[model samples]
Each structure stands twice: as structure tokens, then as C-alpha cells.
Target: MARVVWHVPVTTSGPGSTTALRLFRLRDGRRCAVGFSSPAALAALLGPDQAHTELGEPALHALTTPLGVDVLVLDPRLVAPPVTAPATPAAPAPTALLQHR
Candidate 1:
């Protein structure tokens, strides 16, 4: 039987570029970024494979909906972060004025 995989977040320290969020999976305590996708809101649980970082057309519609039969397991850690009030924009810099004697 295939080992159960747990979903994880792609925090700052996690691998993968900002263009696509890093999809992590914890199998038997070992964490690895299995894939990356921008459109896919949720990460899919695949049998431990390296993530595809290439910036190209996504052949697969969604991570969970692969080409054929797939196993997807959910974890509690995949919760949306708490919403916080937006920060106020900084004030513009002062303009320089020249004085002639």
C-alpha cells in the first residue's frame, strides 16, 4: 500500500519560485515539495515526486485532477491564513526647491 501523504504550506523557506506556490507533502515525517501551481488553490497528494518548476503551459488542469487515477489525502495544516487589515501606504517624499542668491 502507498504511504499516506500530508499537505503542507510553501512558506518563505520552502522551495519553488513565487510565480507558483510550492506544494509540499509529508510522508512518514519527510517533507518534500512535490509540485507547484498557481491556478490550483489546493495541493494534490502524489506518490513522492519532484515538483515541476518550469514556467510553461500547465498540461494538467488541476493538481488533484491528474490524467488518470490518483490518490489525494487531506491534512488539517492546509488551512487558510488568518485575514489581517491592510497596511496604510507610506507618504510621498518631499520635493526639492532651489534658491538663487
Candidate 2:
């Protein structure tokens, strides 16, 4: 029998460029780890630019358990579009001041 593996999202952390498992929060604010059954499933929910790695279900659980994360969401559907921050306004140029002798 073929074993099932999942695509887990990851983010770079610290100066050493270590990869960390990306966790999500539920509507109630509880933290949960997320994984996708396929690369397409992951991209559909998190977009094509998201970074990920492949792991089995047991491996995913082992990595998340220590972080107090017990829930593993697989192939989750989005109820709404993802939110993004508004762009920051450009800074104004400094003006030269004339000094009086």
C-alpha cells in the first residue's frame, strides 16, 4: 500500500535561515497546524507563492505537538478571500533650512 504524504507550509525563521512549520488560528483564536494533501490543494488555499515541504501525517503531528498545536487542518477551504495590508504612503522629502549668522 502507498503511504499518504502531505504538503506542509513553512516559513523561514531566525538568522540561521531555519524553516519552521506554519500554523494557523481558528475563528475562535485557537492555533492549529495546516497541511495539504497535494500541491494544488495547498496553492488553492494559500496561493502559488507559498513555501511548503512534504511530510507524512505522523511527521506533521510530531513537529506541531511541542508547540501546543493539536489540530491539523488538511485541504481547508477558504470562506473568504485572504486579507492584505494597505500600502504605506511615501515619505516626504526634507527641506533645506537657511542659518542666520
lDDT of 1 by residue, 1-101 (tens): 54333332333435543534344345445333333333132334222342333322222225434433133333323444689876987678998999999
The parts of candidate 1 lying over 4 Å away from their true place are: 2-32, 35-87
Candidate 1, poorest ten consecutive residues by summed lDDT: 52-61
Q: CA lDDT of each candidate?
A: 0.38, 0.89
lDDT string for model 2 (22-72, tens) is: 888888889998889999999988999889999998999999899899999
Runs with alpha carbons beyond 4 Å of true place in candidate 2: 13-16, 81-101
Q: What C-alpha lDDT does candidate 2 achieve relative to the native structure?
A: 0.89
In TM-score terms, which candidate is top? Answer: 2
